[model samples]
Target: MYYVIRYGPAEDNSADLYMDPIPGKKVSFTRGERLGTLPLLTFRKRAGDRGAFLDYLGSSPPCMVVSDRFVEALRSVGVDNVDFYPAQLVDEATGKATPGYQAANVVGLIACVDAAKSVYTLMPGLPEGGAIPKNGIFEFKSMHLDYTKVHGAKIFRLFETTSTIIVHESVRDAIEKAGLRGIRLIPAEGLDAFY
Candidate 1:
């Protein structure tokens, strides 16, 4: 159930990819590096970072989920704002995407479901909300996991949350690999043209 969310250079000026988007950015500190690493399917949480291993790492405050190792790793790598609340908030919402919805967009929160599993997940996500762009997520090849085979293509409700992310489920296999190509611009940085 581990996943990676990374920020990459935008091929075009469609979406402005800012640094912090996931609540994890505000907590884990290492989250950005973790997400930026490529081939996420093979990514794993840093050793001693799991909830049960905290004691061996150090005596963290009850409120601190961000581990010392995580912070050091992020700092060493020059990345700040690794948060953990984004994933937890998804659970707080009880499988409905909203609690972690990004505010700027009406419905920024989403539940990315892997249709094969028939359930939404919180493990893998876009590191910075801006990398995901405010719109045109489906423009490129991304696996859309819809157990119900939702008919409304590129249309759905985005949940609401202060600690939010635009959750989307794809059947493509972690994510749909549409293959990088060209760019197209539109209001809200629409998907690259002919993606």
Candidate 2:
């Protein structure tokens, strides 16, 4: 299965999607030539509460999953096992609508699932360590954040050795600024050019 993870803007009302009690800052990035600041999603945390992708991936990985000649190339190479993991926030433990989950972390977890598809995946918001059916191929969206470093590194390295990491052209600068390498950047419209 192929898991394609991309850092793009949120699809709908982020206020409803994210669980951050504190307000998030508007962060700037580019999609093609257009530049804008996307609302970076943060998790809402009370004093003693602590939970994240790390706690989940420590045992298993998050949502398993991605596309585009990206589409052609994938087809040419016979790489059809793809899925997109959505970017959302929820309590990993109860799988309820608690709060305190970063969009980027969510994406990373999705990538984690794609990397290791052997283990089954829980519901998108459910805690990391759980069992479910093994369905391969997924696609998903996510924002950029620092918290995804650990998961990103592991996943990126896996891509380096095993799979291919295809990043969108818009988020390339941001990814570079964040010091992420070994990615193939291509336009959203057509995946003809990759670097």
* Winning model by lDDT: 2
lDDT of 1 by residue, 71-181 (tens): 343334333233333221121112322222111112122433333422222223534232232322332222333324323322222221122122123311212233221
lDDT of 1 at 23: 39
List TM-score per model, in order: 0.19, 0.18
Alpha-carbon deviation at 148 in model 1, angstroms: 2.1
The TM-score between candidate 2 and the true structure equals 0.18
Candidate lDDT values, in order:
0.24, 0.28
The alpha-carbon root-mean-square deviation between model 1 and the true structure, to one decimal in Å, is 19.0
Candidate that scores best on TM-score: 1
